[model samples]
Target chain A: MSVSLDPVNIADKLSLIDELWTQRKIAGLNDYEIKLAKLKGEFVWHTHPETDELFVVVSGRLTIRLREGDVVLGPGELYVVPRGVEHCPVAEEETAVMLVEPVGTLNTGDTGGPMTRAAEPL
Target chain B: MSVSLDPVNIADKLSLIDELWTQRKIAGLNDYEIKLAKLKGEFVWHTHPETDELFVVVSGRLTIRLREGDVVLGPGELYVVPRGVEHCPVAEEETAVMLVEPVGTLNTGDTGGPMTRAAEPL
Candidate 1:
């Protein structure tokens, strides 16, 4: 599908989420995938040992808790979680975020838990 | 630098552009790079033989002209120009965009001209 004609409205997509946190794949560029994720509360601490993950805040606030320090992001701000770094994401309220990573990446990375779920393609 | 604390603001970065079209690299993701660009007119036609280009519109509008047709994008919209596909970008008005591509991919792709320039890291 052509993304230009139907640009994914992040708010519209996030509003349909039934779970506390959910990820929806919006577009795929060869080996890379762009996803929209709605997050609330806290996620399981995890690390992607093979690939970096790019997170762009679309709305609300998000924080990546690391052992060294915490990274907080606001709308229009982006952060890249380096590979092999342990991090946990937390959202005080409903938040919308954009994620860029490899096509087959898992949400929980090297760790898995109840938060682990396959991404739904938009 | 950590991306979380210094999250790149798409609007703030684009507002400082002095050229008709300029790209600024905000962060690197292993082999990929995230860039912000401000466009106000037509750019040279080009094609990347080895990598697809992902373009996400942050504000205003942008059109990617291809031999098959034209792909137009607006705020929050995204499009991926497949590798080796001849294309040209044109912005009727001032527009802010985010680009995701390989680390060393050139703006003009296989073709080179006055439009070719090095990307400034943010």
Candidate 2:
């Protein structure tokens, strides 16, 4: 069966996520986790050993940092962070994003730190 | 690193998908494919025994038909068709959709037909 949601009209959902840090699970599979998150400020550093993570910019600007370089992603741009790569995602302003990761994956991965934003949806 | 795409401001991307029949794979994992598609008219009757397919309308409306009942999904609506369920998606007017399904999936599944839409991107 088919149903759809216009990504352009998800204000309410975004507002909901603003007060929370969880990546709301929209739909996903064993290979990836598709989630929507509201983010701002500097996020923790982490890596995933099981799967590559992708971020698609929908609104606002998102900055991704690696040891070598940093990418500034705007709306309509996408970035792929291969598995086992260390990186950090930060936003100077409020930004909304869609995250795709594998199931049973950890947001923090092997770097178990206090800043690891690892938790299920609230 | 982090990137995000706001679901509410995806008009340009939707327009790009117009006049197209393929599910434009945006991002994915080993188990699923996330795609954006522009659709009108009746799609094939098919089933996926390996995964539950989800349809989210980003704009316009969508309809899903099952052997028993059909569901009419609006812009904010979502529907998940369980695996092994025979179903068809039909649209009478221009519609945009976001699809979540497993990778290497057959849109028509076991009973392939001319109506089955299978192809890589153009």
Best by DockQ: 1
Worst 10 residues of 2 chain A by lDDT: A1-10
Quick one: best TM-score, which candidate? 1
Q: Candidate 2 residues A6-97, lDDT tens each?
A: 22234455666644335776654434445778778887787777677767666788888876678788776667676767888888888887
TM-scores of all models? 0.92, 0.75
lDDT of model 1 at residue A13?
64
TM-score of chain B of each: 0.92, 0.80
Q: What range of 10 consecutive residues in model 1 chain B has the weakest lDDT sum?
A: B1-10
Candidates in order have lDDT scores of: 0.84, 0.66
What residue pairs clash in candidate 1, if any at all? none
Candidate 1, CAPRI quality class derived from DockQ = medium
Off by over 4 Å in 1: A1-12, B1-4
> Model 2: what is its DockQ?
0.16
- Model 1 C-alpha lDDT per residue in residues A9-119, reported as the tens digit of each score: 556666676666667887887798888888889999999999999999988899998877888899998899989889899999888899999988899998988878888
- Interface RMSD, in order shown: 2.7, 7.1
Model 2 TM = 0.75
